[model samples]
Target: MRTILYLMILGLGMSCSNTSKKNDGIEMDSEIKDTVTTESLSTSRMEADLKKKGYQTFSYKAGDTTYLMQQYYMVFLKSGPERSQDSTEAAELQKQHLAHLTRLYEEGYTSLTGPMGDDGDLRGIVVFNTATQKEADSLANLDPMVKAGRLVVEVHPWWVAKGGKLK
Candidate 1:
């Protein structure tokens, strides 16, 4: 069951991207510029920047278009062995967990996160934009729920096209 869930999440994670939503009939630009740089970067420059930050990336030409693929960490939050916390403690931990994830998103470390719909051992998923698996793992472990042993993380390296979006 765990393996199947992991595979399903992995597939979804690979398809997920930081995409722009359409407003009415207008199409919004999907490319997200770096706030620190405050300017749009060329393909080569972007590649260089990602490399400088220890990110794994590659580019390939698909007919007339070029696609840039980047490595990201997908963390599966599963039910931990220690689930004996009281209701109040569990609630507090849940709040803290959300706050932690929000901070990570604001800090540009997490790309996406949310709870699973089914009541399974797989509780949630967090896609991290960190360069290394170790960094992602460390950040995930910092979550209050994980620290409290209510949740544990299983991380995998996933790849996606830069600025790709769900259709």
Candidate 2:
């Protein structure tokens, strides 16, 4: 009985910790959004910055997958605390955002898709079967997050390993 009680407490503590971390991101994101009180930056400008950084971008032609050709479609999302704190709404939004991913998975357009939130930013990634970067583009367009401004979409090339590949 004592062991069970201790384990239960541990689980509850872990849950609380996770919730706190998630909320922290939401709060921080809100602060960041407020900081950018100037005219909202344009999407094109964001894309330009990524280009300057030489981020892996979508390319049909095979390059150096090992050297740097590895490609993956990605979207970096900046969200406010208001949206982040509302997990119920967030889940709904996630469903809408992943709709295309769900479809593509069945269609075998790619292997896996997921959204990762960290440091007041959300990053979404989708693995593809081959160099066909179109799959990522098509699905990214479908994500409601991209459509809504909760996230920004940037399609890129990615290399896959056995662990990396979903299937």
Candidate 3:
């Protein structure tokens, strides 16, 4: 979907890091480590921070690589049964919905959000970086569109690599 693609592009843009120098024919791990350390917290420190914030997280091993998997809540916004609002009211609700999403992003509660390309029952998605599904659901339900019955939300737990980025 276009929404998914848009979120992927946004994520890739945000994840760009400083380029590191190569040593001879190989890239030095230390250089990579240093870059990561400078841009954000170290893995152990990040894990500790997440724990302190009550976020669910775990370390995953795949062959020689280890990844930090963090739990997030994905809220699927669907078309609601109540669609009889006038154009003016609907437009106002849409504006309020966008403002709500912006607030969540600014508050560090959402990582990604966008509408789908099609006009099906599934309207959009919001990836909430909350500690619990209840919190995510509560926040999503606060959206003006949802409150006005223009949209409804179904939330589910999703796990993602802490710093994984799309290429």
Please name the candidate that would achieve the greatest lDDT relative to the true structure.
3
The 0-to-1 C-alpha lDDT of every candidate, in the order given, reads 0.87, 0.53, 0.88
TM-score of each: 0.75, 0.41, 0.75
Q: Give the TM-score of candidate 2.
A: 0.41
Per-residue CA lDDT of model 2 for 24-127, tens digit only, reads 35323444444443213333353355457553432222321211133444433445334453677778887876676687778866666666655546565666
Question: Who is ahead in lDDT, 2 or 3?
Answer: 3
63: Cα error in model 1, Å: 1.4
Ranking by lDDT: 3, 1, 2
Candidate 3 per-residue lDDT, tens place, 1-167, comes to 99999999988775554344467553436566676555444666788899899999988567435678899999999999898999999999999999999999999999999999998999999999999999999999999999999999999999999877768
* Candidate 3 CA-lDDT value: 0.88
Error of 1 at 55 (Å): 0.3
Q: Cα RMSDs of all predictions? A: 15.4, 20.6, 10.1
The TM-score, computed over Cα atoms with residue i paired to residue i, of candidate 1 is: 0.75
lDDT of 2: 0.53
lDDT of 1: 0.87
* lDDT digits (tens) for residues 110-163 of candidate 1: 998999999999999999999999999999999999998999999999999888
